[model samples]
Target chain A: MPDLNQAGLTITPGTWLYRLPWIGLGIGLAGMAGSAVLAQGHLQEFLHAWLVAFLFFLSIALGGLFFVLVLFATKAGWGVSIRRLAENAMATLPIFALLFLPIAWGAGQLFSWWEGPGEDALLALKEPYLNAGFFLARAAAYFIVWSAIALWFASRSARQDDSGQHSITRRLQAASGPCLILYAFTVTFASIDWIMALDPHWYSTMFGVYFFSGCLVGIFAFLVLVMGILQEAGYVGQVIHKGHYHNLGMLLYAFMVFWAYIAFSQYFLIWYANIPEETIWYLHRMHGTWSNLSLILAVGHFGVPFFFLMSRVIKEKPRLLMAGAAWMLLMHLADIYWLVMPNVYAHGPHFGILDVAALAAVGGVFMGAFGWALRRRALIPVKDPRLPESLQLDHA
Target chain B: MAFLSPQLPSTEEYGVLGEFDSPRSLYRACSQVRDAGYSRWDAHTPFPIHGLERAMGLRDSRLAWLVLALGLGGAASAMVLQWWISVHAYPLVISGKPFYSWQAFEPETFEIGILGGALGAVFGMMAFNKLPMWYHPLFASKRFQRVTDDGFFISIEAWDPKFDVEGCQKFLREIGATHVEVVLR
Candidate 1:
């Protein structure tokens, strides 16, 4: 590890991360495009699968944005060393806005409301809000607002690292409070417009919080995985220790529980209320093969990780933490699958080759973009006021 | 009246108690004592000192395993209780659900599991450490009374195999212990 040098202690990662091989990314894109071409008659299924994969990556980016906002809002110190990772993750927002093109183009095939409400008076009553014009407008608004905030914070952070100005930190703190509130409102509407509107009739007030919880857990898992990779490559372990891993692990664990709590609360309320409108959503998910998927979700998403990450030693151990992180990433995919697929299949679970193709394609592009952003900046917020604290942080 | 009472015998020396001014010094002394293979010894501090536990050569408490076992047992019991009561004793369908619904039992099972874990943590900590005793040999030493204050003390028991009284006292002094006294049982 290099000592603090003339350029205000800039710490750059190896060129490998920046000059990452693109063959895999190219294969991913080709596979995804090929899937859509091969499934010509099954464009509906392709779109549905694409939505799931799209939302999966989008959630990670959104989650990263939220993390950047929260660290600033709370004036957090111990997270500064790793904040660069989050900023890089969040910088993918503009790419997601571009990725939204496919979904927007195929809106007619994907969303039932886009086709105009049938005899269902409920949808008709909600027609104004669910209309294609308003829906697209809302989506655009979400992207613009999110991209602006993410770029603002990331660029500010980058500048601060160079200038070492204290007021920039104060400026970020002041802006975070209002930005967070706007973020909440935007995500709430976005969740409704994108996923909840798929079924048209099914709705839950807790959907926004539930989705946000999942996003947070997904981001934490992504962070853990990235950190593990960096350490394995002999990049960051000198500054980060088991204590940092412990904090990261606890965050992942906490968000997992939060997701469960919101999920269970939604289920319990819908079940207890016995309302036909709400119960219909659960009924669709709970019967037949979907029932088994739901059961696996409850146990795998919450139970297994709950017990696995409970131990302090496991939380601190990099290999074990990586295992949990990989599991969480997979579980997040399963969760998104369960959320999106049940609508198209109606009868039971139906996973296709296209699903895998879409996941890989979108995942490759996302990773490529992430790598580009990561390369453009220092691996750590070198000149942050709290970088010293983050460097010396001890979990105990 | 005082002259007429029988005099008690002098208190026997238990071991040397070394007092340090700060946690760092106490931690250093504990490391030296641990390196010297003095097993029957413990460190006392006004507050928990990080790394001191490692310096004292103490293993992690087994309370976590105890709590986990009890928690799982409680969850099982809760599930069984719900199944028996709902399915066998007085079966009734509510909200069109089955007589024995696993989903319905989750909330109660979770609650009981936490209860079991909480109870296990409290009792297990006490049982593992042999705590809550009204009397101990350390209490016989008048100087030990300041343990709950700013004092940092490390006591090497006489029962230790390598507990040479003068050597231990001199070792404590060399390691920067402010005072060394022979504690009485």
Candidate 2:
């Protein structure tokens, strides 16, 4: 018989776990400041790079928030043990709201539509929607809605550990339904307002879904990497086992495929329609080094990992799964880079010092915030109604 | 007539078969037998029992690797065949596009990859389980027929290095098996 009286897996991370985030935050601040000083003459380049980095981190946090919402909305039991990590990840959404200020400030440099209603009929027509004041308002709304949902759910989850009440579970489940709808609408518009507006003249209806797929892949990969580290650190290993990692790997693999599928569908539809305005997006991307990057996205982002994660052994083995997860995180960064950078360099790929600094700056702050959130509570939802089910999960 | 002739096979024992009341008991028996270093043994149950495979010392199936390889091969073949037919064989440029279009080849490749994976999973499972045999010596025992019903059984073959008639029976009973019997060939 399985041991019933085994020690509970609640844990508080050591000082190092807390310290790493501060170190990352320090690096980020120093790096951004250094990059800002370095790019004194060309401030536009810095803005573009910062927007890319900010959106990359935001996508991950948003994805984390989405996972929490969907897990509760679906009444899932499999993720109960791991849900606190997701809640912590979700709590980082407010930081992204703060981080959006730079993007808000840099609107003129990053978006073509932000250049005012000067001559171009299309720009004039899109002005009402793409104006700076309205853009900032929409962004604020998105953040408010997101932060409220994330904090509300996370607090209830934390409270459950102390109280162990079934009503909390019922409340979360009831709230999640409308929260998911809100997420879909907000994410859809946020993608439209933020990313798609960069190439103002071009549009694809599926862009929101495309971005959504990447968000899931990014967050799932981040979860796996973080969970692996926590396990290796000898905390929560008893509660979160190979089965959890396997399930996570399966999710990562699934979203990887979904991203590919959505990406391909968008490409195919655009290519098939062949309208000059629509095709211009693909045309810009399919030329020069961008085309090569596109191919790499196909093979590296989808094909290699698809086969690698197919085996039960790889997902069951933490090191192997960690490697896959890390690679995916890099691929996700590359994916964001590919989406955002092409507007500036329209001709070819450009890997500059600013890009690295921007990533480090944004990633460090994001990590620090996420770490702060994670340290605020128990690592596992100890009193969750489904905690036993999650703890007993096996891949059989 | 002699009970057995030199040319004729002897009506000797195959091995001992034991019946357990529950999957847990059968699982315990499997573990005990596996720990005792009996290699040629198997547990049969009406439904799959979690951890029984581990208790029986079974390793993961290679079917996933086989399916992945087959799936990759299928996708590659699909892409190559489409490329050859479109670019090399026919060279028909339908829409003023490039003759070798990888984007256009994606759907076919994906479909064929899924096809290959499904085929591999089905056939590999069948091959691993050694299915569709017309008969087995175990079918000769009337009680063993209940393995398809509610019965849980462990059959240790005579070919096992540790096999002995009386000792095996005692071992099975000690491991919580309710009934024990011998089979003949």
Candidate 3:
């Protein structure tokens, strides 16, 4: 029998975990800022765009943590070994909740739809969903829902180790259906608030799916990167079998396809309709400095990832698979940069120091918070009733 | 008289020469013997037998894993190559678009990943199964020639410790075998 009481996995901060990645951030920020300044474009707007990027990447870390909880709650056997690494990131939600204060502070500078001193015609028009008060309230509500679901499921699984009953598994499964639905709704509105509102006049019915696919892709990438770190350190020795890697690889493969589908659906839908409000969104992105960024995203996000992830062999190899996963994470960062930067840098695409520093600053803080959450308990839900099923999963 | 002394292994002692059988009963008997755990025997159908892998208790193929790895490698290579070309190498300013527009790269990235995965699967399947095996050892038997036509057969090799030329002939005859053949390797 597996041991009931076990110490959780520990990822000490010495792996550059605590120290802020200032070097990369500085370089990135400098590149972005220098480009904007030299071009004599809108400096203030460019910096604010970088700030939004920091928030966007933070969402990746937060969303990953949520995925970790969902897998645990469902006793999802396929992702067991990788689930712990995901949990490492999920534990950072409360930190992100606090970090969102900056967006609240710079409301007018970032979102043109937010209420300003004047009548704010656009803000008034979107009063139902785009107002500052409703925005922060929804933000809080999203956290509340996500945190409750994650905490309840995580605690139940951990408690099962001592209880050794099937109830914990049953309970989590019962909650997963509703939790998944809630996750979908919450993410949809969250995307609407964070990125979509950047261009309030523009709308796509498929925008939610576009954001969701990237989130899941980011989730897969983040999980792989974290697991790679753990494996490199020798944590999951035998429990993470070849079959498990094969499955994780396949899921990543599946998501690569999914992300592509949603992305295309959004583009195809908007382009096919060709309305002024919608067409102009593509117009800004497809011309001038933005056009090249759009094309790069086209090939980088879909073309390369789609083809490479399609193979079965690449998904199975740990080193090869992780390399792809890391590449995807970088792609996601670039993807968000493309989505966010065009708003600020009307002159061109900026890839400078502030963009880099802001991301590092947020990442360091989020990691610090996530580490604290992991320290509270064991990495895996030792008491989960489905633990055995996951421990020796047989496949055809 | 031979009962008192140990007998020698020979095709003549096995009784009659090999004979071909129709595919239906041959497959049925092969399956029954397989179910009985006769590891030394092999089925010889005119064409590839469907569900034979499972019937033989073969383990799942590693081909899927190979395909997955190849797909991942392809995606990685595509991204880096795209990045290198756009950012470091060529860095072309096409149509006023950024040299590193990720949106445009998605379709190509997808293609590369898929191509790698496909190549991996085909190659992996061949490598894992040790394919390109132009021949099987059983082809040496004269009776085995019918396996290419409208015939199905079973040959329990002489190497099996339980195989006895006389005893096996009697066993086959009692089991309603149309013809029992002793094959020379």
Candidate 4:
């Protein structure tokens, strides 16, 4: 009943996130320096990696908000106990909304369509959807809708937890069901608008699902990493048992397979079609420096995890699970860069200072927001009627 | 009723229906009552009671019926939508394919149907269970973890025509229950 800070050593008066904005600034500066010093040809490549990493982080923060809604809508007890963790993830949404500025600022450098191809040829082709006005409008809409939902859900949940009003719980559940459906449709179209449309020449109906797979996997990885950090800090130790980890790991494993399947299917479908227009995207990726990154991703992202996560015991073991989760996190970065960087640079793969610094910048921002949200709330919904059931949950 | 029950009801609050422990014992009791032709009897557990549907004289879930009905509707809509989109909307010829290739369009339709069926099943199950429930009387109990993980329970409602609290409790205990606590109605 006392404030979380007064609950003693479990929660402190202040969160570690207050220090993160400056850290983010430092990383951004370092990344800017690296881009300046990098090879002239590789400059665009470095910029692409930096921007892509920023977008990738932004996408997770956006999708993380959606995850909270779905769990709430389903009245999913197992996840509800740990819903605070995800709420913290969603709290980063506003920062991401602010981030679209830099994206728009450097759009010409990032997306090819912004650059000169022809007076009307490229512009006319992308006219239906790719004009700057429409692009900015849709991006704004997405940000507005997403931020409103995230803030609403977080406030309602936090408020209801204190109020002990049963109707509040029901309202969230009801809202969640529809909210999840809305999330699925919006997220799908948003993916189409943002990443899929980047390569206007190529099209895959499944691209939305592909992005969804990666986002889902990325969220699971985030959950694993956050849970590990929280456990080290001595919270939710009993409430989040081995069973929750196993289920989270299982989701990670499943989504990883899904990502692989979708990635391959897109490739196989395009390859089978063998069209000049469609094949060019793969042609650009599978040759030159991009080829090695693709191969590395194929083997490392899918193959290595497939072998290690196949063992159920490893998923259940916290340390081993963290290893798997951490691997997925690294891959998520690689995957996004793979999608974006090749479009910018056709040269050899380079993990320039910018790439690493950009990652740190975004990651610091993410951690800072995440930590602040968590410290304000209970680690688990201790008053939840189903808390005991979740604590006792065991997986076969 | 610890974890499952946020608040436990007092003994005199609800007409103390009847109760049973392990699922098998509950199932046997239900079957016996069902065979003896008791009409208003139901089993309650922490989760979906395996095989208890049969003992409780329930036929296949009504959800399956809802799914079938929805699947048929979805197929019909899918056909109409595809007709409108591919045939009427753009009608652009590509790869020498027909404008109205029903077979080519069938995969998406069939998928929509199955998806609709799944939706039907979920909603039907929830409706039948009267779920999306925020709170329940059982949530009051602090010892109710076994409902989900390892425990099973069955309650015969006080509303049942044949309901008698003491008699039902005696019958439940006679059916080899480990413990029989009256489920607060």
Candidate 5:
């Protein structure tokens, strides 16, 4: 049984975690100031780098949203203890609307279709949907929908901690299915608009699923790391055990394979068709050091982790599983970078200071929001009806 | 007797069987049995009880290793076959591409790997469990039929090194078995 007492549930004051929000916000401000100084002659580069950082963090949060929604939709009993952490991650979505300002402001430079489709015939044909007004409007719609769902579910779950109401669980479960549908459409178009539109003439129908798979990989990695960190900090006590970590590791492995499948499928179809428009995208990526990064993603992201996480013993070991998770999180960042950076550095891969600054900027703010959400409630949903079930979860 | 035929049962003592009213009692008894250093014993329940394997002191199965070996072997063989046929045997230039196009070979490789892993899992499990046996001495007991219904039972085969007909029966009873019986082979 779990230590259900208040001592294990809440963050103790003056711990590093209690001050995470302030520290994160401070780093975010400094990062933003550094980015401003770095952007003088390289506004286009800064914007592209910022977009990569934004999408990388945003995918993790979106993965968090999907995780929370699925848990409620299935009324999964074993995941209830960890659901609160995902809720905290999802609750950070509203801040991404603010983080999106750079991309929105630099629309003219980052996206080719932003400036009235210019003289390109194919782009002009896509102008109806790719026009600036509609694009911004769609981004707004996505944020509004995402923010609303994130806030509603997160706030209600937090409220359940106070009210101890089972009705809230029922209501969320009933609403989860529709919310997921909204999530699917919004996430799909959002990826198409932001990442795929970077190479406006090139498109793959599998692009959205590819992005979604990466999001799952990101969230599972993030959860494993966060769960490890929180436990090491003396919170959650014995509430979360090896069983939960094993499950998280399994998910991390499963989604890594899923991401590889979708990514390879997209490449396979384009390579097979041999159409110039479709193959051009792969041609650019396959030519330079970008190809090296692509190869690294295939091996690092899927091949190595495949064999590492296959054993039940490794998954049951927290430190080993966390190591795999951290490596996966890095690969996930590289994946987003691969998708966005090839357009900017057509010659090869470029690692620059602005890239790190942009990540620090966006990531610091994301952590700030996540930490703020974390500090606001119990680390786990203390009053959840299935909390006992999650606490008692053990693998046979 | 025919060569390699199934062994015939003898009219000698085969095992001692114990019946418990519930999973909890059976679980506790299993731990005692395990701690008492008795091997060649197994617990039976109508449905799976979590952690019972731990109580029975079972080690992890070796089936995963079998699946992994067969799966990799299958995929590698598939790739080699495709390369041989496309590059060496016929050398047909389909779609104007290279002779050894690994991209085209991937789908078949993956499918065959899954087939191999699946076959390994099924057959490996059967091999480990020793399935398709026509009969067991325990089946002669009328109460043992309840094993598929509401019964929780623990059976200690007479062949166990420490087994003694009267001693094992008393041990089961002391460990909370409601009913204990000795079965004939």
Candidate 6:
């Protein structure tokens, strides 16, 4: 058994993570500057790349928010030890408001509907909801709702570490149900505004769920990777055991399947209906080299990971599960790229240095904020009532 | 003539029965028995004790493999059946699409796969546990009846190579069994 003392639950001095915030910020600024320089001639490509990176990291943060809220709502105990990591991840939501500025600035170039739908009757009919002013307004509202809930839960949980109050947990539990309803609405609209709006003429009610499933897949993969890294650095100690990894792996596997289910559902309906307006969106993706990427997404995102993560032995072993997590993260990026990039490059897949640069810019700031949040508090919610249960978690 | 009836042990004794006072005692005794390399034995309790399977050194069941095999087989057969019907046997182009529209067949394929996996899990579990067992020699012991409520037991069958009635009963008693007896046919 691990020592459950305060010292064991904290980051030791001189650890590499202490430098993460500054280093991550440095890389972030450099990547942003690089993207700026590259955008001189290829402004459209830059915006599209930035949008992909933005959505990728944003999904992870949203996933963190969902995780914390669901844990509180369900009164889950097994996740108590890992809750703080998720808390720190969600606390980075406010920074995404800052990161979203570039997407906002380049919205005209990124979204074709930004300049008013011309000669397209369908887009004209959908004008009020798809207008630029309302889009920005809605974006601001989403940021406000997400940031408020994220900060409230994160701050309360952090405060509970000092006060060690059970009332705080009960209050959070009470608030989680309402917060989740708000989350579902905002997340659905936000996905519609940010991603599905890229092709204004075509729409799928399932798009929100599809994107939400990806968020879950992204966050679970991120959590697995973070847990593995923290354990490797000797930070979280032995409090997190094989059972926790197994559980995280199970969640990751579940959401990965969910993503496929939603993706396939969206496609199956569109394929069966065969309406011109609906099928046009898929036609762009199914043509030329994009088809290969689509096939790869179907197989890589679902098929390979399905069998790879099925075995209990794989999930229990840190290295194997971490490997699976890393691969899934890559596939998640591919999924977002598939969503946004197909709009920009209608002919085929074009992966460039801008994509990497944009990822670094958005991803670096995300990591920097996450590190800052991590260092500010206990790595685990030390005073949570359920910590003991979480620490003693074992699967039969 | 006797093939249709439940078979009774031809020998006078069935095996040794040890009554543990609680699940804790049974768990520890199970570990000892497992360490001592007894193969044909099982523990009975009114409710599950967590990690008791680990204490008894039980390996994971092979049911998952069965489920996967049957699930894939079901999906494959469903797809093949659709292909044969649409592309070869009838070749009716129903929605202005090609004769072989794999897209339309996927939902049924997925559902059938789940059905296969569900059936596999249920039947596989039963098969592994040797279910539909109407008779067990341990049921002959009056104390064993308490297994549905309060009793905890460790029964080692006589067919085990290491079983010696007296030695087994002494071992059980040493391991904190409240009562040890030789169950009969």
Per-candidate total of colliding backbone pairs = 0, 0, 78, 18, 0, 0
Candidate 6 docking DockQ: 0.71
Q: What is the C-alpha local distance difference test score of each model?
A: 0.86, 0.86, 0.66, 0.71, 0.92, 0.91
Give the alpha carbon lDDT tens digit for every residue of A139-253 in model 3: 9998788677666765665677468688767776777777788888988888788888888888877777777777777777877666666567755654565566667667666
Q: Mind giving the per-residue lDDT tens digits that candidate 5 earns over B42-66?
A: 8999999998998889889899999
By DockQ, the better pick of 2 and 3 is: 2
Better of 3 and 5 by DockQ: 5
Candidate 4 residue-wise lDDT, B30-92, digit = tens:
788777666655566766755567687876556766877898799789999988988889897
Candidates, DockQ = 0.26, 0.31, 0.06, 0.03, 0.71, 0.71
TM-scores computed on chain B for all candidates: 0.90, 0.90, 0.65, 0.78, 0.92, 0.90
Q: Which model is ahead, 1 or 5, in terms of lDDT?
A: 5
RMSD of every candidate to native, in Å, equals 4.4, 4.3, 11.8, 13.1, 1.7, 1.9
lDDT of 6 by residue, A1-396 (tens): 234667657767677787789878988998999998998999999999999999999999999999999999999999999999999999999999999998899899978888998988888898999989999999999999999999999999999989989999999999999999999999999999999999888899899999999999999999999999998887776689999999999999999999999999999999999999899999999999999999999999999999999999999998999999999999999999999998889889999899989999999999999999988899998889888889888886
lDDT of 2 by residue, A281-361 (tens): 888888888999888888989989988987788999999999999999888888888888888888778888887788888
**TM-score of candidate 1 relative to the true fold:** 0.91
Identify the candidate with maximal TM-score. Answer: 5
TM-score of each: 0.91, 0.90, 0.66, 0.66, 0.97, 0.96
- Weakest lDDT window of 10 consecutive positions for candidate 5 chain A: A1-10
- Higher-scoring candidate on TM-score, 1 or 2: 1
Badly placed stretches (over 4 Å) of model 1 are A1-15, A21-28, A394-396, B1-11, B139-145
Q: Total clashes, candidate 6?
A: 0
Cand. 2: chain B TM-score:
0.90
CA lDDT, candidate 1, residue A227: 88
Q: Give the least accurate 10-residue stretch of model 4 chain B, judged by summed lDDT.
A: B1-10
Cand. 1: chain B TM-score: 0.90
Model 3 spans with C-alpha error above 4 angstroms: A3-43, A46-52, A65-75, A116-124, A394-396, B1-185
Itemize residue pairs with steric clashes in candidate 1. Answer: none
lDDT by residue (B1-185, candidate 1, tens digit) is: 44333222243657789889988889888899989888988898889897677788888878889999999999899999999999999999897888987878989998998899999999899876666555666777777888999999998887787877899999889989999998765
